[model samples]
Target chain A: MTADVAVLGAGMHPWGKWGRSFVEYGTAAAREALADAGVDWCDIGSIVGADTVRGGYPGYVAGATFAKALGWQGARVASVYAACASGAQAISTARAQILSGLADVVLVVGADAAPKGFFRPAGGDRPDDPDWLRFRVLGATNPAYFGLYARRRMAVHGDTLEDFAQVKVKNAAAGALNPLARYRKRVTAEEVAASAVVADPLRLLDICATSDGGAALVLSSVDFARRHGAPDPVRIRAVSTVTPRFPNTVLDLPDIATDSAASVAPPAEPFRASIARAAYEEAGIGPEDLSLAEVYDLSTALELQWYEDLGLCGEGEAAKLLGEGATAPGGRIPVNPSGGLASFGEAVPAQAIAQVCEVTWQLRGVAGERQVAGARVGMTANQGLFGHGSSVIAVR
Target chain B: MSRKRTPVVAGWFTGDGTDGEGEADFRLLGTRCSACASVFFPREDVFCRNPGCPGGELTEVPLSRRGRIWSYTDSRYRPPAPYVSDPELEWQPCTLIAVELEAERMVVLGQGAPGVALADLAVGMEVEAVPGVLNEDTETTWTTWHWRLTGTPGSAEAEADAKGAAGVVA
Candidate 1:
């Protein structure tokens, strides 16, 4: 197993469509995390920033930008971009530095001010970019891909529209309890059914929205945590960042065609499952050990897919598990007690770190209204565009 | 004066025939790895993606025009830019289908034929390729391929009419 890194602090800026700069949101989150960790900015040995493409120049050099905003003490800096998995990649970088003894304390931060309406590719006639090609050739928006998966589930597993709606209902209930969530009001199945359809078989309520938000975490060596007078601390046990095996059969986002399985037999385990398995393997724990999970719910249907991928239930049994209240509050293993992306929408770079933040809070018995009672272990899973895989396991 | 006809992207589709007789001549062009025997749509003229095999030459090959519907969906809202639809016109939802070519063991995405709505599709239904115009103006007609479900009533007649209207033979 990998050496443990203590989560010294976690923080976030409330998610919304606030038309502010990403730097401001990230800086606010960083300060909160630093305060929570009881460590001053000058004490931080290193900083890692999850990169954002929207904020122009500052977004690209997010680490330096945030360091400057926090009054640069000349901390070691690194910036990483892996689409939705950017935050997890940042956390991984910090963990590596701490494990290698390059730094005793590292700060990881991700934040974004999202564009209005559907997320689109960068402007240009560049045909080489797969993202731009998918938009230009097929006009397949992100929701369109979500619709395909939702419909495929219905056809393959007999999942229903109500099943999808129930996901929003469950998550919205949890989000309502999260003070930092953008949309905190409870959502009803009736309200979901009344929502307009964005893509066939998936409605506006079924899909997560785009929002501006930030999430940050302060990570320190286990030795450092003990030295700081904390005998025991919430520790991150694993961070899985694996790429998909060759001949990925699933038609993922931004790709018009699946990798041909003709030449080589496809891997038995699909990409999403591998992401969770890697984390489980590295942490020396299985899905059965998970007290709670935070999955990327880009759409309601996708959440059900994660249940199976994370091995929470058997294939085609996610709908059954949801129907049985097994994934709801007061259930055997509650999932997404932190409101999930359904409540927060997506801030891209901020999301994976936000998941870790939620896991850390739950493990510490400090999640307040959204706390999973006596939560001992938690996991967060997300995948990004291209071939980025992210999953983190935290234990107390 | 005749409006100019052009392929949206060159070398992805077959035929220079403009007559209605060439309706059967339509096919998607792809490439196959000579070493690994992998097939690629939108044609990979580059090296093989199979990590296990040494690099091989990619040869252009016409893909199967028919395949089963792996899954289908439609855009209920207007997509973002670079899609080239006029903003002024009333938005029309477009059906998109993912077809699984059994021989190649791959799935390719394409737009559905005109008037084929979500109600007309099923997960395993068979669909065939047919030439269609994506958009047109006084200057140029953008040519592309559309998938029409096989065995639909009047599908053949409709295909012939669409072919003639687009001024394509096959």
Candidate 2:
């Protein structure tokens, strides 16, 4: 296993549709993280920025842009883009810098100002781009894909619409306690059923909305953390950023078809399962050791999918686990204690970092009302477009 | 004014220029890796995607027309472009299906044939790819593929519905 990086501080700008530039939100989050870490901007040896592709030219050079916004001190900078996994990649970069002795302290930041309505591909007639082709040829939006998965779950696992609604109820309740969450009002199964249908078998409330937000983290070498008078801190034990193996059988996003499995057999473990396995292996911990988890609830059904993938339960047992309250707050293993995307909506670039921030607070036992009791080990799981797999394991 | 019949994206399918006036031969086209025996839809034109295989010539291959429905869903709202649709027209929810081709062992996604409602479909139901219009503009008729249920008299009804609703994707 690789050496761990100490999570010196974690911060967020509070998710919302605030109609502000991403730079503003990112700067605010970065400043908060720096203040929390008791590290000055000029003292940081490196900075990493998770890019928001929707932010145009400046978004492409996010590292330099955020560095400029925070006032340049010639710190080493790097930018990464991996759709929803962007923030995790930024965190990975910062952790790498610390472990390699390249930087004693590094700052990671991600932010976004999302547009209204469904996210569309960049303007073009490029049939070469699968994201564009899916929309152009089949009129298949992101919700359409979610609908397929939800329906498949109903057919395969006998999961009911009410079961999906309960996930929303569970998450919304927790989000109500988190001031950073955008949708603080607790949601009910009745309300979820009453919401408009965006895709078959999935309602508007089942899906996450796009939002404007930012998240930042200050990471340092363990020695640095000890020298800085914080002997015990939340440590990042693993950051898994794996890609799908060949012959991926699952219908992933931005693709019109799955890779053929005729010649080569499909992997025993699917992509999402592998993502968690890699993290668990590196962290040297299993699901039994998890005090809590922060999963990407892009859709309520997807949260159930994560349960199975994360090994919280066996395959096809996710609904049963949820039904038994195993995943609810104060239960066996609380999930999405910060409310997940269901409550926070999706700030894309900021999301993965935000998940880590939640885990950090829970591990530090400072997650006021929604804290997982006696939390010591926590994990965050997220998947992004184009086979980008992300998961982070942190422990105190 | 007569608009020219065109494939939405060329070389993805086989079609004749009858433009729904006649039963033009139609089939979805894909490419197969000669080295790895792997198949790709939307026709991979360049190199073999299989990492185990050394570079080999990709050959044009027609995919199996018949398959089983792996999953299905319907879009209740209008999708944003580059999917061409008239904003003036009331949105007609379109059923989307993911069909599993046994021969290729791959799942291909397509719009369900017109009149095929979600209530009419179930997992593992048989489906076949057929020629259909994606959208139309002043000078171009964009031809594409649609997956319609196979077996029983319901298949006939779906075909009739598709013909009746020709060129109206939304």
Q: Looking at every candidate separately, what fraction of the true A–B Cα contacts under 8 Å does it contain?
A: 0.75, 0.87
DockQ of each: 0.70, 0.76
Docking class of 2: medium
User: Model 2, A44-131: lDDT tens per residue?
Assistant: 9999999999889888778888999999899999999999999888999898888889999999999999999999999978888999
Q: What is the TM-score of each candidate's chain B when compared with the real chain B? A: 0.85, 0.85
Model 1's DockQ score: 0.70
**Best candidate (score: lDDT):** 2
lDDT of 2 by residue, B32-71 (tens): 9888889988688898888888978899999998889999
Per-chain TM-score of candidate 1, chain B: 0.85
What is candidate 1's fraction of native contacts?
0.75
Candidate 1 residue lDDT tens string, A65-91:
899999979899999999999999999
- Candidate 1's displacement at residue B4, Å, is 2.7
Interface RMSD of each: 0.9, 0.7
